[model samples]
Target: MAVSLKRTPLYQEHLSLGARMVPFAGWEMPLQYTGIIEEHHAVRREAGLFDISHMARIFVTGPAAFDLLQRTVTRDLSRVEIGQSAYALACNEEGGILDDLYVYHSGPEEYVVIGNAANRDRDFGWLAAQKRAGEPVEVIDRSDELGMVAFQGPKAPALLQSIVETDILSIPRHGCGYVDILGYRCFIGRTGYTGEDGFEVLVPVEGAVALWRRILNLDVRPCGLGARDTLRLEAALMLYGNDIDLTTNPYEAGLGWVVNLDKGPFIGRDVLAAIKARGASRRLVCFEMFERGDIARPGYPIYHDGREVGRVTSGGPSPTLGKNIGMGYVPVDLAVVGTRLDIKIRDRFGPAQVVRRPFYRSPSLGG
Candidate 1:
């Protein structure tokens, strides 16, 4: 029997826009509306709206909320004050990445974790299982009750500010606060995966459609996951299952900065510290195709020194840069910029060169 895929509250709105829906992480989501390139350029040059309600929103509350987070996440939550959010990782006992998530210090002794859509069940299960005996913490999955949307791009701030009551600019990067959106108090965070100034709003499921429609009225182009992937790739942001997973560690995945061994005991602290001391054998690096008419996709073989060393984890054409880019794991020595790599394309090999992460940056940032 085929299981029914879930749909977001904004599903109707997506359909109304003539979006092409596809199955993603067990959710029927928009793959594209106008076109991937058009939507991708809309975000880079202007603004784009995304329905990200499929991602899991889990809440940890009560007296032990902070304590439980400290024990489960890789980052030192002690430094995260109320109204601020931090990007962190959940690791198993072996120091393998369970998921990369954002932790929002929503209130006093209350935290909300936003995890990948595909890992919703597993992430909630792992967090719930960590509640100590007699511990007052409650790990609650509110994914079904809440809906999330991302308004991302250079112009996302001003456009979102026009609809919300709270001062959007006052919300620091990686910060969150309750704001009125379409007459409802929604949690808004100034964080995004597109390497641009953007705001993600967590609203009650009832208000999601209204809020989405309101943003669309402001001329924000409705973008699907296709554009989302290309935008994130230009920024060199790693997708969960592709770039990192149970078999991958943070250090090798170019995410060592999120791990804090000195933060005291956590799930994988001991193993991670040992791995840190010894160094990682492989590394995840971003590369760009040197030739036209060739693109690297996930699982494509990567070669160096005339031998197959690894495979592409994530790859696609970057509309913003007008180039084909990809990310893949390779020997540490071969991960440096300017290193030439060969990506197996069908029966032939295509040339690519290792480049700096983030192929695109806003001019306002002064790169």
Candidate 2:
């Protein structure tokens, strides 16, 4: 018999809000409410709330935690200061990506690593193995105890300020602070997947429903995974499983900035160094359809001079731009801006042009 999936604390609340739920990485997750386009626009214009509880939250703490983690991830954890977060990647000895995650330095020797839901088990096991190797790290899977909610958009600060005691307007991007939400102590981070100003609040699982309701009562629209995907895509953020994976490195995915080659030896340092010398064979590029009513999607063949050159990885109707935009990998020579190409949509080739990444620029949240 098939096993039942787990539900977040806000499962019932999502249902009550008329969310269209779907199975995501072994969890019952909301796909959309009031349609993907509406929810996507809500987070871009106003503010939208997301139940991101399905993401795994694990903590690594101990005297040797810093040293142990330094050997496992691509980023130089030594650079991350307390109350700050950084994007990191886990890699195998051969330099293949094991997973991409966000690492938060909660204290001097304590850290929180948020891994993708689909790679939680593998990531946990890998960290456990490193700890067993006598690395002074004690890994704890806090995924069950912690829940996360993302509030994003232009009005995010305003909505959150009304709920929290501290003035959120002062917190810098990538900064975090502790706040009490209705008797529950939560960690609020000024980070989000969408190209919008936002905060991701981590709270106790039991308090997730109450917090969700409170945000809803404040008129923050409930957004689902569908909108979340489109928003991130429009922002040119790479999705782990789709836009990037083990086969793709940070340099090819347009994330080379996150890798500090100048930093000392890292898990993928040698391999990345070699790649840097050789140069990437292919590059990720963004493109837009020329005419209206044309919808492009992943796996669609891209053509140049009537020959197949590459394929789209992520594409859709961008709610923020009100046009069809997409990301794909193509020959490095053909990845320049304004390069012309044709995208195969429904067996018909449509004209498109290569454009810059970050299809949308968010308004400044700092006052």
Candidate 3:
């Protein structure tokens, strides 16, 4: 017998909104409410809300919490200030990425690690196994007990400010703070996956539907996983399973900036150090079709000079740019901007060219 898929706290809310539910990471999630392109433009132009409760919220506490995390991720946790968040990657001993997550320093000796929905169990198990025989650190999985929602776009702050009593605009990028929303305590973070200015709100599972309904009353577009994927793709954000996996390393995925080799020892530090010294043979790059009508898709072969050089990892028609865009891995020498290539689609090859990172950038990002 097949195991039943999980449902988030807001599953009913999604159904009420006429969302087309589909299986994603072992859960029945909304693929689209209105439509992919319509929802995608809603986030880019105005504001949109997403049911992100599928993400894992794991908590670590005790005197040795910091030390345990220092040994588990690639970024240096010592530099992260209280109430601040940083993106980091957990890797295996061989330096292959296990998952990329956000770490928030909530308080002294208290931290929250938000892992990808699909990697929750594995991430929690990895952390639990690292507790030295009698260490004080505690790894607790709180994903099912809590709910998360993301409000994104240029007008997100204004919409959020109207609901909460806290001065949310005061929170800087990558910062987290506590606030009261309709009498419910919420953990709000100034971060998002859509490459826009937004906040990810975490609250008790019981309060999820209330919060979702309140946001819906504000005229915020209710987006689904389809738009979320497209928005992140146009932003050049790496997806865990597709863009990076056990066979891929941070250096080759264009995530070298997050690796801190000088911060002392951590999981995969030695191998990453060696890889950085030797240089990566291939790198992740963004590209766009030179001719219309040819769309790139995952697993499609990329060619240069009549030879297969790489394969597309994520690709789709960008609603914001109104063009076909995709990301893939290619030889380092041919990854430069302006380099022309071909993508095999069905019976013919379509012309494409390397472009700068991020096919779209919202004007509301820097403010």
- Model 3 — TM-score against the truth? 0.98
| Candidate 1 C-alpha lDDT tens digits along 68-166 | 999999999999999999999999999999999999998898898999999999999999999999999999999999989999988999999987766
Question: Please, what are the lDDT tens digits per residue for candidate 2 over residues 199-283?
Answer: 9999998888888889888988999999999999988887878788888877777777777777777677889888878888889
Off by over 4 Å in 3: 1-3
TM-score: model 2 vs. ground truth = 0.95
Which parts of model 1 are misplaced by more than 4 Å? Answer: 364-367
Q: Model 1, 6: alpha-carbon shift in Å? A: 0.6
- What does candidate 3 score in Cα RMSD to the true structure? 1.1
As a whole number from 0 to 100, the lDDT of residue 21 in candidate 2 is 91
- Steric clashes per prediction: 0, 0, 0
Estimate TM-scores for all models.
0.98, 0.95, 0.98
TM-score of model 1 (CA atoms): 0.98
Overlapping backbone residue pairs in candidate 3 total: 0
Error of 1 at 204 (Å): 0.4
